[model samples]
Target: MPDIVSFNKGHYYLLGLGVCVGVFGLIATLEHWFSIILSEATVKKLFRVAVLGLMLGLLLPHFSHFGFSRYFQSHGYISCDAASHRWLHSVILVYTKNEMLCKELIEARK
Candidate 1:
């Protein structure tokens, strides 16, 4: 199987890019709507506040892991340590076995 760690890293990279684009769009929309009455400095300050709020909104839940960790586990979230161990085990197995047999073993494990 493809490395799950790399797969999830790629997924998060794309997700972060999407969030950047969305935040930029939000700021632009806010400036357009409020530019008539708001000063440029005020708009800039508003943008700062908006970005701060967005960051806090995204991160606050992680601060309290009481229910969140259980929710994540029940939803098939694998911890980083577990993922690294699994990947290392697979690499060792593949390296120690015959190439053709390793391929078959990997496929069968899937």
Candidate 2:
């Protein structure tokens, strides 16, 4: 097993991604059930609730110390940690320019 002490930002990001994916899957399952068991209007409302919950779940990590640092780094809110900041910039910068760069960055990080 990999040492917990050896885990880095990339590992945490992967874990966060896994959690987001799991929440997405769960929301989708609930949506499916709502469609089958609820009236159309109720299904729509519940589906919206599910989607909102999923979005909040995905954003939860961004409120953490590690995630907040990375997010601020990506946005240029802080500059004390250049190395880590650059890594996060690589992840978020592509959103303003080329989406492919994010994929390349993640691949390179791996």
lDDT by residue (1-110, candidate 1, tens digit) is 33231222223333444565666666677658766555778767766766665565445434433354454445554433322223321321112112454445456656
Compared with the true structure, all predictions reach lDDT values of: 0.44, 0.45
Please list all clashing residue pairs in model 1, or write none if there are none.
none
Q: Which stretches of candidate 2 lie over 4 Å from their true place?
A: 1-36, 66-110
The root-mean-square deviation over C-alpha atoms between each candidate and the true structure, in angstroms, is 9.9, 11.4
Q: Given candidate 1, what's the lDDT at residue 30?
A: 64
What ranges in model 1 sit over 4 Å off?
1-6, 33-102, 105-110
Q: What is the alpha-carbon lDDT of model 1 when measured against the actual structure?
A: 0.44
TM-score of each: 0.31, 0.29
